[model samples]
Target: MKGVMASVQDVGAPREKLQALEKIEQDIAAALSSAASALQELSKDKPAQKHVDSHSTAFIKTLQEVENGLSQQISYLSQVTTSQPHEGSSYGSQKDMHMAMHRSAHVKSRLSELEKLKMEHLMQKHTGILRSYSASNDSQQPLTPHTPQQPHTPQPHQQPQQQQQQQKQTREQQAQL
Candidate 1:
């Protein structure tokens, strides 16, 4: 009779263990269901996220276009200033010309700085986009901005004072004639 009771107890132990495991499985299923529903809810707003991304991309593109236009204009102006013929024999006029040349140089430097800033902004924006895209794609690819090789535009050098004076004298003699 004691052996029969021991056998019964052993069977009950296994039954209890099975019940506990079944309960654990049910709980896990319930949690998964809850998570799935939450994901579905969040997915409903994905269109809004996409719309914002598109708008941001468009804005960046427009800004880039504007920067490019300004850069071209600056390049053209720098070229025109450099190509201008020298003038004036008077010390005062020479001083004014010197100041103008300095100012032109300053402008070129400022424009170059602006271009650098614009490029940096563009790179940052692209990096952000790449990060977000890679996150969505589950990719491990690194983001790198494509920096194009820009031909160095030679800066305008100041003309010699003697050459400026000679041009000025020639202009004066022609005017007198």
Candidate 2:
């Protein structure tokens, strides 16, 4: 009876240790499950983040292309407005000359329109910059109006004509003297 009692006690001790080990294993499995769920959630968000990033990049690229096109148009208008008229070009008749003059007037008007658009674009860009700067600085100062300066371009033909007139006037004065 004494030996049987000792054997029973030894068996009970091993059963308790086995139960503890099974509990520890269950806790480890629960922790691993929680970590796996968290990783899955993060992975799901990654695709959304990538989608947003791609959209923003595309938007920026499109905006840059539009800005480049506007700049090119502005340059073309400036060139047309500053170009010298070909006065020596042979026109078959007065009607042809009149048509040429009309075309020139049309181009000038279009150039003026483009210039206004350029000015507006510049104003908007500056306003945005100023707004951002003021916001960052926490300043509430009134924004001053910015005036775009018009470049003075002298006509190529006018200078020589003016010099000739001046020489002619000098000759007349010398003769009078």
- For candidate 1, which ten residues in a row score worst on lDDT? 145-154
Candidate 1 stretches greater than 4 Å from native: 1-89, 139-177
RMSD of each: 41.3, 38.8
Report the C-alpha lDDT of model 1 over 5-94, residue by residue, as the tens digit.
343233334455355445545545554554455455456745455554554555455455445444443443443466543221144567
Candidate 2 per-residue lDDT, tens place, 1-177, comes to 565334323333445535544554554555455445445545673545555455455545545544544444344344335552322223245557899999999999999999999999966876665565446643343433333343233356667755454444334333332
Q: What is the C-alpha lDDT of each candidate?
A: 0.50, 0.51
- Cα lDDT over the full model 2: 0.51
Give the per-residue Cα lDDT of candidate 2 at 129. 59
